[model samples]
Target chain A: MLRLHGIVGDRRDHALHHRLHHLEHHDAIEFLFVPEADLGRRRLRALTDRGTECAVSLDRDDALYDGAVLFIDDDRAVVVRAGAPRELRLRPQGTEGALKLGFLAGHLHWRVRFEGTDLCVVLDGAAADYTARIAPLLDDGIVTVVGNAN
Target chain B: MNAPALSPATPAKTAPAARVGIGGPVGSGKTALVERLIAAFAARKVDLAVITNDLVTHEDAERVRRSGLIDPARVSAVEAGACPHTVIREDPTLNIEAADDLERRFPGVELILIESGGDNLASTFSRDLTDFWIFVIDVAGGDDIPRKRGPGVLKCDLLVINKADLAPHVGVDLDGMIAEARRVRAGRPVIVTNCRRSEGIDAVADHLEREVLFRT
Candidate 1:
């Protein structure tokens, strides 16, 4: 298993981006897709798209972000790609219910947006976990789970 | 002048300190327990640091720093704002950053005691923030507390029943409270302590040394 200690650069860096583009033409770019929740973790073990096993142990203060470049060599490059954002769509029963639901989401610091009458919440973890926090509102019919937005 | 050259990524030189969280209701002796543990670990010659999450003020952090049990510089304070539980459990980025700063400053630190602001029984420490956590409850809070089975009590690595000396005055049966706590925790470790008198503190330190630090 190859042990990755830190991020060399990110794809957003122009030099690295150009290098990645050049490497792609040679079929030498591999990607590791990391989930949103796991980004904050300092230690992780995952396999690349080509089935190469690697262990990542970042510094205490460092967090993994999208497009992190883990390793690069003359022949190949390894990059990290964050998974797609997962979200839950909810509809409150009334104005008061919307206020309460909004308050709860704000208190929990959940990233959310309003779309028509629905509240779309970007989830950091499982959808069930977010719903569980608002279970009382659901049981009382103050809010209803419309569906997954993504 | 020569241009600086890029260096290859290097692994972290040392492991981060073990983080332990102490959480409980208002006036449940969370700060008192932190002070006591500071003394206990100091006596054991363990390198330590502390982070206190005060709801609106730095009162708890100031108190710990003034105790003189550890270096004042080693103590860090985090304002948890209105949501105490949220800072420790939901969005613990502030606390994580504080702990990381302490580790960076004190490389020899073996443990960091994170004291949460007083909160409700539903409060818990996120696994990403704490390696081990203890929920502190007092006898005066009522003997029914354990039977209520809040997540903080049921899920903590250790449960502490503080202010045991007040059990008689508060009409709380200490033995029954301990038994009920053990029952709710499904036979997990529970230690009774009177922080004012420093009683049963060694037991708590022993548990930390064995379970968290793996010193045993």
Candidate 2:
């Protein structure tokens, strides 16, 4: 059962999450509300045994693990906590012209716009003086970092 | 006859002092109630700590801290993650942990008051988490609320109808509302108060003294 077990955010959010957890974890899926106050891996295992699929919704802006069931109540604020195994989102930022040139050379074409920092940004920063850093490796499955105003 | 002998194989455990919860909609005067309890408990010299849940702001927690009745650090606030009922009822893990943390921080504390974030009806505390609880509603919401009989109102140990002074201005029949509340709960305790003015606080305190604090 997909029991929400417990909400991570605040005390007043239990019922709705309980309802959501129960609804998602329906018959045959044993749902248990585990308050983090008393949470342990053993508790997670216990729920897993109750049902095959285990899903937990985290607190507001909270990210624990990217479990099967994620509770997204509102999107106006930053997600401080997401129960997903890995919370992936776009990040944005503003930098000097040279930094922007290197940044674009690394990920100029992308599916989603994000201000996040990854290996690409880190590499780009280190190779700031090298002009042909990424151009040669772009087609070879190797991401390169080159910053030039051309 | 002699009492049964203790078993040698039994595990030893501390009787963790009971935890009590107080919840209700916003503007129902939960902070005011806490203030009153602080004064009342101080009169009785009870050692206690309070945990408050604020959905979008720390105003309530701040109020109790600044009240000067208890140490400001004795109060901690938890954010509601935009969904108040989930934290208190559905999940309640963070609140439980916070309460336990407080217990760890202050061993002398005998009473714990967990205030839920301001939320709508249908909010209730977990029996496993809280030993007893109270729900506060207000006259400003109208007198028919009792008749609606939300789960929170029906399940709470004490139902407080706060802001009594606004009944006439708000066009509510205060007597009828209180009577209907009694009718709904059958024999449960209900208190009418103007928490803003500190009226009817002692009666509420009296109920807590007997029911939760176990001073009797």
TM-score of each: 0.58, 0.55
Question: Per-residue lDDT for A1-150 in model 2, tens only?
Answer: 222323334312565455544433322222233344323211121232122333232222222331223222321111112221121221223343335444554444211122434222211112333334444434343343323222
* Cα DockQ of the candidate 2 complex: 0.01
DockQ for every model comes to 0.05, 0.01
Candidate 1 lDDT, A46-96, residue by residue in tens: 776556666665666677888899888766677887886567999999888
Model 2: how far is A122 from its true place, Å? 77
In candidate 1 the C-alpha lDDT for residue A23 amounts to 72
Kindly give the number of clashing pairs for every candidate.
Answer: 0, 47
As for candidate 1, its clashing pairs are: none
Instruction: Name the top TM-score candidate.
Output: 1
In model 1, how well does chain A match by TM-score?
0.55
Candidate 2: where are CA atoms >4 Å away? A1-150, B1-15
Candidate 1, B97-201: lDDT as tens digits:
999899889888989999999998999988689767899999999999999999999988799999999999999989999999999898989999999999999
Worst 10 residues of 1 chain B by lDDT: B1-10
Predicted candidate 1, C-alpha RMSD = 15.4
